[model samples]
Target: MMAFEFPGQYYEVIRGTLRDVHAETAYLADWLAKSGKATGGRVLDLGCGTGTTLRALAARGHGGVGVDASAAFIAWATEAGGDGLEYVRADLADLDVAEFATEEPFDLVVCLFATLNMVPPEALVPLLRQVRGRLAPGGHLVLDAAHLLGFVDTYQPSMIAHHQRDGVLLTRMVHTSVNGHTACWRNEETILARDPDGAVSMHENGFDQWVLTAPQIRGALAAAGFRVVAEHGGFRDAPPPPFGKGPLVQVAALDG
Candidate 1:
């Protein structure tokens, strides 16, 4: 796996600038509720960053385990403790479910915010299989990935964007490329923090992400012994969009 540069600072910047953490939390909670998967059961939030989803799940009366590879993220998440909520620091690609959910199976396992796109191609299916192994009977796995149509067909070249909030300035440059069936994204970011006394600090880091198509992703889930139960474009509960129309989400169940 490629090293993630400045993960802690990136999280902090985005949480304060580009993200409405509470809105996202509530939106996901509503999705689960509408899908009838909001039962107060054991839940695993794969690639959970800063425990945003887990906190919301716990509020819904569920037992939640939040796992991420970033120790900084886990540390921050741990500070937002709630009843029936826990955070684990580990790489999802090499996760050992037994080490965490030793006593029971998870009713719902979620990998959201295009998290699966970061998994190396060779390791994607194996990771899915591991997730499958930890699910309870009739349990559901929900994952989201960038849609090829949105990413490939509509590919845009390198561009720069900026965000500023609370005296912090974040500048991001994103480059997109497609090689055959794979899409590659490279992001370079620089952050500037200015203190009240005019002292300024700066940080910079970048990461690469590889993405696959909806069919490829669904095929991987099937290979991992999961059957697709429902799929949608973007976050809403609407019908799955046509290929290349929007970002995709898959809701699957362990195969018979």
Candidate 2:
């Protein structure tokens, strides 16, 4: 179990600018509809940082429970409470779906933004099995992970980004190291934040992630009793090669 920790306050401040939440949510909705799934379904969001995506889903009539290992993220998300939304702080490896079964089984389980890469390769099958046990009859799981090529192309040796919003300035410096032989990578990140009152803060964290291939992911899903239904290149319609230079997005359903 790798610890994927981030500065929650800084993350929340810059998340909206990091990606297009509306577009991502729309893409998810479209994917679900294309798979013949219904709207207004319950969702379980694994590695839901700051609950941005879950909040967007709720606005479109879906209810969701967001789980993250970072207490800061959970706290920030909980503070921004919305209808049909709940936040829980728990590591994915130690998750117990039974605790969230009060309503009904989840219609969809999402592990986005390469969150699954944080899970140790050996634990993936068991985690998938756990997710399978908590899904509705027609439930589906959608996830995105960094493939070998993507990792190589996207994660440079070092990079820096600066963002300023709402009287707060955030600077993130990232250093990435790739171990091709092991298909693993480590990211060391340092964050510098300047608040409205001119107070400065610095935070540092690092985590390791595995670069999985399409076949590897499919095999893991199959081992967990799931049948791969769709594979895409970074949320697009076209499928990426097994070792392409983009995020591998997959959708799987229980193999009955």
Candidate 3:
């Protein structure tokens, strides 16, 4: 299996442009408040690439840690440090909550943007159990994952996007394929960077990702002692069949 890794600076710039950080932060805050959670509470962000979400939360008086397996990502996030945010380099599959013993239990744990889908099948349940153990009572776990319906409807087998800003140009190509319950993704990025001296540099990188189905994810959460409290299609609350036309966003709480 190919290990997943971020393609560094150029990719981050393009990704940041693609996502609306403020909107996502607002959605998270609103969801938590409506669920009866405090506004300025501790948050634990898993697969937090570059810590943008945590940084936004910090501005709202929230504090927390961001965890990712990418050393490059950790370094970048650490450099862009927030007032009360810390970045840790660690793999979620083998996460050690003991490392965070000094801090209070997290009020919210998030694995957004289909990050949970990247967890290997064998480690999915164990990771969920670990996450459950780290949450304070009444705390919630919010995550989004790929599902068959969504994948089929939205992501084409092959697609490309381009963006240019701040003397940098990025072209990203996405290829996807599904076999059984697993979806395989390959991302190819080409970057052209211009310098003040009228010189240009080019860089290229590729990454692979595998995603499982919504039922598989829900089952893992249940086996890890969580009960689904709310389900949504791309952040908006929706009725079940849960596997709608968008990513499966689930809010789960510890079960009795």
Using lDDT, give the best candidate's number.
2
Pairs in steric clash, model 1:
149-244
Model 1 superposed RMSD (Cα) = 3.2
> If candidate 3 were superposed on the true structure by all CA atoms, what would the RMSD be?
3.1
Question: Residue by residue across 128-205, what tens digits does model 2's lDDT show?
Answer: 999999877767899887776677667689999898878889898989888878777888888889999999998887
- Best candidate, TM-score: 2
Residue by residue across 1-256, what tens digits does model 3's lDDT show?
3233444455467757777777778877775675466466788999998888898888887888999888777888898888888888898878887887455888889997767766777888999998888887888888877665655567676777777656666655655555544456655554455544556666555555566666777898999999988877566555545325655678889998
Candidate 1 vs candidate 3, lDDT winner: 3
**Backbone clashes (count) for model 2:** 0
Which stretch of 10 consecutive residues in model 3 shows the poorest summed lDDT? 1-10
Clashes of 3: 0
Candidate 1, which segments miss by more than 4 Å at Cα? 1-39, 153-157, 164-169, 175-183, 194-199
Instruction: Tell me the TM-score of each prediction against the true structure.
Output: 0.82, 0.89, 0.84
- Spell out the clash pairs found in candidate 3: none
Q: Clash pairs of candidate 2?
A: none
Name the weakest run of 10 consecutive residues (lDDT summed) in model 2: 1-10
Local distance difference test values of all predictions, in order: 0.72, 0.81, 0.74
Q: Put the candidates in TM-score order, highest first.
A: 2, 3, 1
Off by over 4 Å in 2: 1-7, 34-38, 101-103, 179-182, 241-243
